[model samples]
Target: MRIIISPAKKMRVDTDTLAWHDLPCMIDRAEVLYDKLASMSYDELKRLWKCNDAIAALNVERLHNSDLRIRLTPAILSYEGIQYQYMAPGVFTDEQLIYVQEHLRILSGLYGVVRPFDGVTPYRLEMQAKLPIEGAKDLYGFWGSAIADQLYQETDCIINLASKEYSVCVSRHQKPGTRFITCVFGEEKDGKVVEKGTLCKMARGEMVRYLAEANAKSPEAMKDFACLNYVFSPAHSDESTYVFLQKKSQDSEE
Candidate 1:
């Protein structure tokens, strides 16, 4: 499991920097961090230890831990003000992998839980989930503020539907299986997330149906907030407008 990111043949700032891959490098550090995994412990092996909500317990700093020896060196990492961090697969275990996957779902507000057998995941767990496609980026600060006060507080829900005039935004670029998960909340009538293992699959015709049905009921989405208002690549474009995705891109990490 030893991982070493061989630097490419260019001045990556200093010709000495390369980001670590999570797999081999992570495996290399397995012996050292193995003890930190709950499942490796005597008392918690078989039990799913309900962890501290997603962001709170993340060991981001652990990436820079000493034994594994990760260094950014002098790489020209930022381009146009975008910063990137390297991930090495240090000490990754099956339990930790599962926990990390679930952690992503919780943060992204996607499915109720992460499932593998749905055919898109790396592992084969037969689960699926859905996401709320609200103004996702705008809600990040809100989520942060909510977490600052109290994490995962069950709160109110607001339903967002498309307007009637623009029923569907089709694209030749639109590939199948495009999906996302975003935070959703509402009163108990909208379905409270009391269980930790629910999957909501809104792909293919199901996704088309949901949006179409929603649009027929609400006009504001199609009329006021067409795809051009945001930043991500839109499904299509038209006169005086360009679309941007309000949800996570297809390239986003799970």
Candidate 2:
């Protein structure tokens, strides 16, 4: 099974941690995107990124100077978001690292889909960003079925840990017969399942680590995940969705 996750908006360059094994599969396409972004003015890019001036300025500098092919960090190590922090791939054992290298795929707006150890430079673009390319209306349209098609080629079963923005790129164009399962981390609120953004990110990261350690080979194996006070809810889960609800703490129970 291939596991899919989203790219974090926050990133850093860490060429010293672990060497990148390969360039992203869609490097040529990424170059096309890079050139487009590189050509845009700082103000234009700032609007596209939808960020504060400081962030926009930083990325504008990165776009101008950072070479995508040179001095790259592994995709897993580059992202500095909470999810990556919890995944903590930097401390993984050789076996666990190997497992993730084989199964983990990071979905990116600029790179389409990248392997865990794929070489990448820090850049700012979100899957939902409205940067029109060629004849496509948005990044999603630009990616088309490319992400799903590539994932289908790797495995018939895909375990989606990505947020909806990135996951939609694959879900909308999955090949027939492919089994796509989404893992939801949430709490039971007012007798309904409610997912909060930060908690879900933490859970997703923890789940990646759990799967790597377990060397999970099947979707059924995922049901065994227990972390961050979450337990699988059979009542809320179906074939395509696995819902894990947070259990109240002892203090709260008292």
**Reference-based lDDT, residue 209, model 1:** 30
Q: Model 1, which residues run further than 4 Å from truth?
A: 1-43, 49-199, 203-254
Per-residue CA lDDT of candidate 1, range 1-254, in tens? 00001111111221133332232212222322233332243233212223333422232223223232233222112111111111111233444333322221111111111111111111100011111123323222212232212112221211111111110111111223421112111112233222111111111112223233333322123323322122323334332232323343467636
Given candidate 2, what's the lDDT at residue 202?
Answer: 95
Model 2 clash pairs are none
Instruction: Give per-residue lDDT, candidate 2, residue 236.
Output: 96
The TM-score between candidate 1 and the true structure equals 0.18
What global local distance difference test value does model 2 have? 0.93
lDDT per residue as tens, model 2, 49-162: 999999998999999999889989999999989899899998999999999999999999999999989999999999999999999989988899999999999999999999
lDDT of each: 0.22, 0.93
Q: At residue 139, what lDDT does model 1 achieve?
A: 21
Give the TM-score of each candidate: 0.18, 0.98
